[model samples]
Target: MRNAEVARQLGVPPGTVSYWLHLDRSRRGECPGRRPPPPCPRCDDTPLDEAAYAYLLGLYLGDGHIIQHSRHRVPSLMITCSEKWPGLIDEAERAMRAVFPQNRTCRVRKTGALNVKVYSKHLWCLFPQHGEGRKHERHIALEPWQQAIVDRYPWGFIRGLIHSDGCRTTNWTTRIVAGERKRYEYPRYFFTNKSDDIRRLLTDTLDKVGVEWRVTRRGNDPYNVSVARREAVALMDRFIGPKL
Candidate 1:
């Protein structure tokens, strides 16, 4: 059967059939270029937007994934964004396009969120942290080069993480002011991730940016990093405010 026919009948992407055929051909020593790889900063020395990359990196580590089929040459980078935050979805797509200006991006709806994805052969090159298993199951650490970018754009990086796995909330209490009872509101930031390494990365960046944070134990896992200090919350507000 023709590959396109098979793909159409099976409701699979045409590229999937092509990838399987290509793999069979390679076993017989026939090698052909399926698709030319897109330009990559690490491979082709293409200029990268350091700030955008820093932000995207944070998103990837928090709620993004690079999916590469074992038999396919092209891989897709997917960032899951909640439906409640339409602005965040747009920002995620924009950051991806900024990082790979020549590539096209798309959104796939799933459950209550959208998967903003872009396909390229160079995703692994750009995100070396891509590997088997969930991010929390593995040791997630940035390369020295990536760390430099984040250091240069700490706010962008923090914003990305906040957009994905963190949130800004208002905490309120009653206070007496001038002999009158008044409601006082405190704005705080919280970043929750199961991976200790990922949490450390956030805290480390927060420290670099002079944003004070403390680890708050939520349930059995101490997965919450809270920024409640007046100065720290103000800093977060300036750099990485509520998810709009």
Candidate 2:
């Protein structure tokens, strides 16, 4: 890593880290009676906005993952989004940057999807969702502070969930009434996930957001949350808007 990257990871000024790096071991002296410096800065030391953290956490739970290993490769946090929706990938990068400022981040180019990844040991501590198998095979719960953040910014958290595992689309249909056929088109927001707890968490937040959502089915999973009513769609659009 470069001086600026080290400074960012250490939460120190670039010049300070530079000064230390420029000095040779023979010339660099330590103060007496002072303890040795830490092996590395804590990942939690990276500053975080509660809402942003919660949103990233939601995305992590929905479609992101962490890889842990003792050798072969560095552990990393990775989130992949469809190539069709580059905006979501951009948002995920921003969110990851904000939360894991000290980690070395990268983007992987693929044929059908965009992947954002960061390497850090402290990331697992920040989010304990790492477990065996898929999320549905395990339980997803929130810490007290995370719950508080979600309570304050339910829409932001919901946005992350929707962007990761959900989608926005237009629905067109025709109905015949009184021998008259009426054609109409409407926009709807839908989220599908296999984790019952995640679906429940999303619905509970929607309840708090005052946006009514209905449970629906999709081929991916039987658990789904959808917003199709005119008013509900309007409300969801207020927060999530369109996926660019």
List where candidate 1 sits over 4 angstroms from the true fold. 1-35, 70-72, 175-183
lDDT, candidate 2, at 92: 87
Location of the lowest summed lDDT over 10 successive residues in candidate 2: 35-44
List, residue by residue over 110-196, the lDDT tens digit for candidate 1.
999999999887888889998889888999999999999998999999999999999999999998899999998888999999999
Each prediction's whole-model lDDT (CA): 0.91, 0.80
Clashes of each: 0, 0
Model 1 pairs in collision: none
Clashes of 2: 0
The reply for model 2, stretches above 4 Å from the true place, is 1-46, 70-74, 219-221
C-alpha root-mean-square deviation, each candidate: 7.4, 10.1
For candidate 1, the per-residue lDDT at 225 reads: 98
TM per candidate? 0.82, 0.78
